[model samples]
Target: MQHALTKVGPDYDVVVLGAGAGGMSAAIFAAMEGARVLLVERTEYLGGTTSYSAATTWIPLTRHAQAMGADDSRDKVSGFLDRAVGNHSSKSVRDAFVAAGTGVVDALEDKTDVKFRARPFHPDYLYELEGATSFGRALEPLPFDASALGKDLHLIRPPIPEFTILGGLMVDRDDIAHLMRIGKSAKSTAYSARLIGHYYLDKIRQGRGTRLVMGNALIGRMLLAARKLGVTILTETEALAFTTGPDGVTGVTLRQKDTERQIHVTGGLILASGGFARHPTMRADKLPQPLPEFSPSAPGHTGTLHDLAFTAGAYHGDTAAQPCFWAPVSHRKRADGSMAVFPHFVFDRSKPGIISVGRDGRRFVNESTSYHLFVSAMYAANKDGSHVPTYLIADAAALKKYGMGMIRPGGANIAPYLADGYLTEAATLDELAGKLGIDAAGLNDSVARMNAYARSGTDADFARGTTVYEKANGDPTHGPNPTLGPLETAPYYAVKLWPGDIGSAIGLVGDENAQLLRRDGSAIPGLYACGNDLQSIMGGVYPGPGITVGPAIVFGAIAARHAARRAVAARKGDAA
Candidate 1:
């Protein structure tokens, strides 16, 4: 249902720039606080890169933890973060995030449509750390009925094409097993029928399915909630500059297509623009040498707002370990001429019968480790130029059962993949190594060593299946070890992998209240930042799943709630 735009004054009370998870949540919180807000996006779609993601948030000490009996605590999380992050980021902001996690989550659950469910066994990435829990810190969005948005459903960014299947069916990773068994069992067959029927019906009506899951569901809920509160939403709008006055950033100058307008604000100016991951200048200045050419993230975070933001005395946080978070990506051109940068995030590497090898055809890092760690290993291994573009080796059976990069499971067409040169196929190990231009003898030796390891049920080289997190991603039914298996299946397959920076780890430094700060540590009044615009709380260390989104939502709430309170206080003073 559409309502007339709510307004506290002539123009607006607050203006939220950027429509990612953080910015969207900020607008909703401001609106709930009785402030008329305008949510703006430079692109036509609202979800940003998050809609292309799994939409998990790593927030500790919530009721979800209690419900799952996760045995997690604030102190445990704090200790782990301290050990993992050290002084890479501001401790004050980190502590603030912990203190407000439960409150923000509870409020969203009780007062808004946004909802989350705990995964009982999704362990933190750094599971070896003392403060790490086996489960419950990570919360995922529940599936959403996108038809609730009616015609506005398209306003949300669609999922990445590579993440979907059968034209546009967005199936969960767990549900994929049931889909593969369509006719094998009665229950699976019925489930597959309903899912396929629902997708086709939705496609017939809206040109795309509306059963939103993962990050899209989360974005949809926020969009619907923002609309329910009469928040004005504008897409294809760009923020030019900030308008300042005695009350600080009083408003923003914006341009929509051909039109230009300056709207003064009575409340706050929130900057949640994704981040500088794609900015050429930032990439050169912040990232390491031999710069990456591909990113799996959405194209919105080009650091477009940073230059304008610097004019207001805001500067980048200087203490991060690296400028951006990482993942080893494999890219291929699609039939539509679009490039698909597939992130190898625990599908094939962690599974049995696959191993990542450098140019010398030797194992480099634990193939089953987290994506961030995998890329970091790539960077480390490439120092001597041996592994910049590593090759992931898997047998034909493994490729069919688990699927390589850019190829989904359920026996997808390997012929097309081979025809496109995205996947290299050969009948023998020596021939496979010859095609990849790697050492064939070394490849033979590596496979023989792997076969011995499989028989012994141990990864003597990198201990691939040692950790709980790695095992969680591995095949549980496999005998001996879940992640340890011989590459004995004939006809090997290979895909080239490159280091891909997924998102920026650095952003404008802010306080616990999510207010942007000057160099001297004083606050930039009425100027706030969240999402990637705000410096990550973990300080660039990949601690676990949902690290980016966890603090994003928490601080977005802090910024909006604080600004709303300030607006109310100012109104009271004027009345007095």
Candidate 2:
């Protein structure tokens, strides 16, 4: 973390609320510019939903992509986004994110320990569209050793319980691949053994596994960078209101622990506090009809900052195609009396021998499409709410191999899941339809058509495996088509899928510089927002993996760059 400032801050030049991807990046970028910074998190943990994410940063034109031979350009991406996002968002603001994305990644890698590697094969979610490619564009954060965080390790939010295994071991893509090939290949066996061995050793030395992967690793790297930069971080701190001067926001009123105090700010107050996913008022107003009962987003984003920002003359963007990014989710009650809401983000739905149908027992959308599209399809099909709580039907063989929703793969004992009513099992297709209240004839016909598609390698009804992304997520070893298969095995299984918002898409409107905008279109001086706190540049369109985190880093950097420049000018003014 060279060239980063070691300045302590009583009167900080930049103060960022929220320790998620955007806020942490803003704090680090400003600190690297020698700006005294204060990073405040209401929760004790450093990462929000980002820590629970796969940390696939969707930034194009980065050196990682170039080195990996990614055939992409700014114009090509612009064209694709223009079609995909259209007039749903501010084109200029979206352009700003695209332009600054590569530079933001470069700055973090060059000036700090934060590092990212682009995968050789990652498709844009909408692969059928023109200007789309099968590889590059999506970058993933390198796995980090959490021990490097030392005593601050616990400050990182734990991964979703359903996502981790072996009592808390977080695994990467490679690790998962190896684990799946256990006993089938000698090399895979050895790799899996070593990985499991390390996890146990980590558990012995640390309460949790020290080998951080995915979102945890991304957050760990940033947390480490913030520490090295000497950015002041106060956790369990609640932001009450913004204290402003004639020029702009001058400070923030905070309740840290048991004490309430106001801190001075010399540059700006940055808002990256997740979104309104958990806010009751915002949910009622912004979310879709029937109002989803579950959400997989991090608990920290309660829209407190958005409300506070309203007092600072900030307004929310209303042009988005949708208010929140959605996912088809399934939930089950845990032994602890808490419900576990799991977003079905590409594990089972696309795999062989599975079909998602509305209550009418007919397929509604491409089963292998992106999670956002899947949920959007749910909403479209359930205009009257009857089609919602759709059923994901899978046979016993598929359930054992791919696992549906909260079910684990390769597990023979579905007794617990069945007993808890998380899964409904039946020995016959007609019996399964009856259990799920599906039309037996429609369900039977749909399954027969799917079986026909499996044999012919073509999805006549829904075009399941036609796109690059669909095939990429499907089981490659399967029949004529990877994502198409017959659901004829005995003892069928079903899980109820509900539309769950993964993150808020609508947020405070901001300029290209990441500065908040007023109702009359003037920039609100001294206030900036990024992450979900800022309106989604995609306008509720889930373009590719890491779309959220990618923009979070970019706009955070934009805000930091402007804030740091302002701080330098202010110092010159004071000196003169």
Candidate 3:
């Protein structure tokens, strides 16, 4: 199955593997520094799993936060990390990230098409923690029009279909709000009409709507900037192995289509391949029982880069408390027979009238907690496999007002879901519990308790809405306790939930400069890592919204800068 080497390409100043936000940022930064760069992606499309994300980056004490009048500082962020992540993470790595994150954002905005706006209202996941803020730590990409990519649009990875509506119409937070109230208010109806009209108009000419939002927007803008910067992008080109010399990694063996070639790289190699979430053996070794089958990550994330880096003497960081970021996901078989998974992050669980229950039919944790914390609770309660497949139970009224899991709100067609076994429906709480194989008596009692809390606007069992983080995810329109609502209506429904991962936390060990480190703590020269390919600075703790992406972009810039400087030094040494 292997192809023989047929040709040797010209050497480049830098080589970047993968085409996600991190890799693209590295390539763009290197090229901007006047280094000839080659960016290779194994998949046909760029962006990788980031396209499926919300693309919000959480970097504290940034100039953006200061600009927004938020009282944040580097010392404060350091204090927060000390308490939130503790000694599990490297102080040097955290310091480097804090120093470089905001500068990277500013540099990209100045030199590339990338742009970001501070989210003044998004709170830290642990808002009560020391140094946590209620606003301005998170930055999201501004929406971008895919029409700017022209035919190149096909090269960028599209967002997940589950994140979109009407086949391919992209919607923002405002658009979602307007959509949810389309029939209830005239202003919302006008907003919907305008959005739909634009979508259709774009679809008429492009065959797909072109207004990309969220992570898609971030990737679209970066790709456009990469092209403009003259960075050479090679898609469907797989890096088979590294070509090392006495000094360090010198090049890579790449398989482009049917032909294999050796491409020399004088600067360095940056590994930003999406992590090992889809790797079978890796998952078995890293995760708890009943390994996750559904992930929001791209299928191209097979951990090939992790293996390749290991072969080059890079060691995976194994000291983190958790191996990967967790999320509760529900799966359904599409018409095409492929499975569709939806991560219950922000939309449904925190909204009024929904509660997650264990096999014994009792609420285990606050339903409005962060997705990572929610799954952590599931893991804590999985001592006897009783919580392996928890259920997200909601009443008919909640279903009609705010859908659960893959089901859309406002009476979306549930017949297909029920028929396909993705959903279970019953006219009464006891009946639903029986269908879900839970104790009917326990469920009835839990529902009765929830009804009392809903009426009183308080959650005594778990304090769901008391925290700033909980209230942030809760439906604002709902009065009293936005996160607490009664399950009094008949026709209860349930969706089975499983532990899922958004990305891997254990990856190549690297220093603050983004240089991969060997087992003995020695740097593997010419090899760098960022994104999920590098051990997370958060040390497996979910601190906030953009922890993964913020560090990814920052370290990407760090790697590029280091490589550029090293390349210059090498050239000077040769001249001497």
Runs off by more than 4 Å, candidate 3: 1-8, 183-187
- Residue runs of model 2 more than 4 Å from their true location after superposition: 1-10
Judging by lDDT, tell me the better candidate of 2 and 3: 2
Cα miss at 396, model 2 (Å)?
A: 1.8
lDDT of 3 by residue, 1-576 (tens): 111235334688889898888998898899888888888888888998888889988877666788889988889888888788887788889999998887888889988899989876999998879998888889989999879889878787877787789988888897898998888999999989988999999888988788888888999899899889888888888899998878788889898879878888888999988777677788789887777777877877788888888888998887777889989999988888888888999888888888999999999999999999899999999898889789999999998888888788776788999998999999988889888999888788888898899899988899889889899888888868888888878889999999989988888899999999988999988999989999999888998898888888888889998997788888889899
Q: Judging by TM-score, tell me the better candidate of 2 and 3.
A: 2
330-390 per-residue lDDT for model 1 (tens digits): 9999888989899998888888888889999999899889999898888888888888899
The per-model lDDT (C-alpha) reads 0.86, 0.89, 0.86
Model 3, position 273, has a per-residue lDDT of 88
TM-score of 3: 0.97
How many residue pairs clash in all the candidates, one count each?
0, 0, 1
Top-TM-score structure, candidate number: 2
TM-score of each: 0.97, 0.97, 0.97
Tell me the tens digit of each residue's lDDT in model 2 across 304-376.
9999999989999999998999889999988898889999999999999999888778889999999999999
Predicted structure 1: clash tally: 0
